[model samples]
Target: MRDTTADGAADTTADETADRAGLRGDCENCFGLCCVALPFARSADFAIDKPAGKACPNLGEDHRCGIHARLRQKGFTGCTVYDCFGAGQKVSQLTFGGRDRRTASREDARRMTDVFPVVRQLHELLWYLTEALTLPAARPIHGDLGRALETTEALTRLDPDDLAALDVPAHRQNVNVLLLKTSELARAGIGGRKKERRGADLMGARLKGADLRGANLRGAYLIAADLTGADLRGADLIGADLRDTDLTDADLTDALFLTQPQLNAARGSTGTRLPESVTRPVHWTPRL
Candidate 1:
């Protein structure tokens, strides 16, 4: 059974499990928008180069990945890590009223492609905003976060034309102000001199066993960095590029704003401790 609050209502403290249910990808309800709307290059992550608005050759007529079970083995690791945060279903159903791109007019299909990425960005903000409300330390700004969440949700319901014309980055900047404050309040409780490494280029750095507790690593480029055995509790990892970062035995018990896609993009071992919000990536090495 799912855990509940004292009154049997869904728990919103720390985990925000109920609030995040709709913020995750539900491909079954989607029309394969990610495979058709987004472009990807032929690299280690993808087996072939696909252009935007062009359906991936591997996408089936039923809107399912033909090679779903063997995506990694077939050199499509990027698809495994990508999550639309539930934007695909929202666009397929609510935004376009269950219209299938295969049957829709060419102009309508083009609009769907354009509107999808916009909603994806908004949904991602919803993910963070939902998380911010669950932090007890961020109670001071709960009212602001709540209002932002409501506004962002309303934006997602806009018509395709309106959604395409929406000033997303400007709104993101507004919402980010609150997230920064949330980070400050949440990290302040951790006992230590917090490190401020916002947007720092730390690519390929040797940081194994480092103490990153309460560190601000927002937008920091940690690509290919060795973070094995690091203590990252309470660290703000909002936009840290963790691609290829080694996380063997790392304790990220309370790491702030660490999303599943970021964890999936990195390398981890069975010993890596994670926060409650995300699960252990299936590709991580097992203990032998």
Candidate 2:
């Protein structure tokens, strides 16, 4: 049976469920823009070097990954970590009116490809702005967040030329200021002296059972670190490299700015705690 709240919305909080709607990629609606427009070099993440605006050899006619299930085994782990935040589909359907670059004119195709990255950047800002709206500590600036969200959303609907002409980095800098304030408000709610490891090089460090409450770990390199049973409540993990970081029994119930890609890159167990806004990765297993 389905559930509903008093306001007739879903029972789950917006961040837990509805927040992802129209924000997460719907590949079915997408024209495989990421595979077609983005260049990827041959590395641990890909099996071949492909130039931008060229369709990947593995992309099917229907815009699906030919090796979707076997991507990792075929040296395409990077694809698994990517989430367009729904920009691909928006570009494919709304912006191009369901036009497939495969069948479109060369110039139109090129324009679509060019606009995609711009819309993607705007959509990412929209994602963070939407998340900021959900935080109670950020209520003071909810008006600002709402306005930013609306403006960013409007940008995604612009014509291809307008999108390509957008100064995305400048806009991102403006958005970052608000996001930093949101992070501060959210972390301050934790209320305690905490570690400051922002931008620290902690690759392969052993941090088992370490106390990191309210820690500022933005952009920290935590790759291959053993963080078993670590207390990371209220930590700011924006852009943190969590690749192979063992999260067994680690507490991240209030971690700020922790994105899905970061969580996906990390190794965790069923014993690991997480914020309600995030979910356990399918690759995670029970602690043995």
Candidate 3:
């Protein structure tokens, strides 16, 4: 693609940076694919309404953003922060054969779009696990990380048809055990693995550095625990009341169902890592 922007030199420089670091969601190679494929509602986050697999009005047929420079003014701040962790490009080029889902057969398009999010999720796990493998603090799980990387890579390489059939959540559950151990080893230097607020009714415990790895926190009423520094690496929070647990520094990165609001509410510093699909919570504002 020719440089259409004013500073053609700047575009080439950016292309070099992107190629070296692996493509981020903002890369031009993506063809603004996510904007067109995903659904959104008319609200504070989205200025206009859109449905799944439908093209966004601001998307140009040339795979460019019509409101690229003024997305914030247009109420697309959500799109600004969205990242596919390299999965978007992979789906566009590899899984879907370098073509947009909209151009594919209806059945193929539906299947591809529906499965993209799921694979994006798995790739997300891969991203986190790959990062975790690099942490010296997680040395105890280095071997496991290597193995996990291989397994997740194998899964990522599967054909979209086969990938769509996968039970990812179940696979995630199996992977969680190893991730739990990595968390445990990393946090052990801070404290032992046990967090007990037994009957304290910690609706939202903020124990980011309070190590709870390997702790049997079963059935604990931590509906919304603010476990910021608390380490829950391998702690069995199974059946625990974590409906809205704040896991900012809690290191539930490898823990189970620690999904969404539960993952978003907690305080965490930059060192506090998590899955790719999920991002660091913007609210906590930790400096650590």
TM-score of each model, paired residue for residue? 0.94, 0.91, 0.61
User: How would you order the candidates by TM-score, starting with the best?
Assistant: 1, 2, 3
The segments of candidate 3 whose C-alpha lies over 4 angstroms from its true place after superposition are: 1-20, 191-288
**Candidate 1 runs further than 4 Å off:** 1-15
What is candidate 3's lDDT per residue for 1-288, written digit by digit as tens? Answer: 112233211122224232324324535666565776678888765788888777788988887888978886889765654566676777777777776655777887776666677767776676556545544566555666666656776887788789888899988877777666665564455445355433456675555467666565645777566666676654544336654455544565544323333344334567666644355655455655
lDDT of 2 at 72: 82
**Ordered list by lDDT, greatest first:** 1, 2, 3
TM-score quality measure for candidate 2: 0.91
The alpha-carbon lDDT assigned to residue 96 of candidate 1 equals: 92
- How many clashes does the backbone of model 1 have? 0
lDDT of 2 at 197: 88
| Model 2 lDDT per residue over 1-288, tens place | 113344432322454456558878899999999998888999887889999999999999888999999988999888888878889999999989999997888898999879888888888787777777777787777767766777788889998888999999998889988988988888887767877888999999999999898898988999999999999998988879998899999999878878777888889999999987677888787888
Report, for all candidates in order, the number of backbone clashes. Answer: 0, 0, 21
Best by lDDT: 1
Better of 1 and 2 by lDDT: 1
Clashing pairs in 1: none
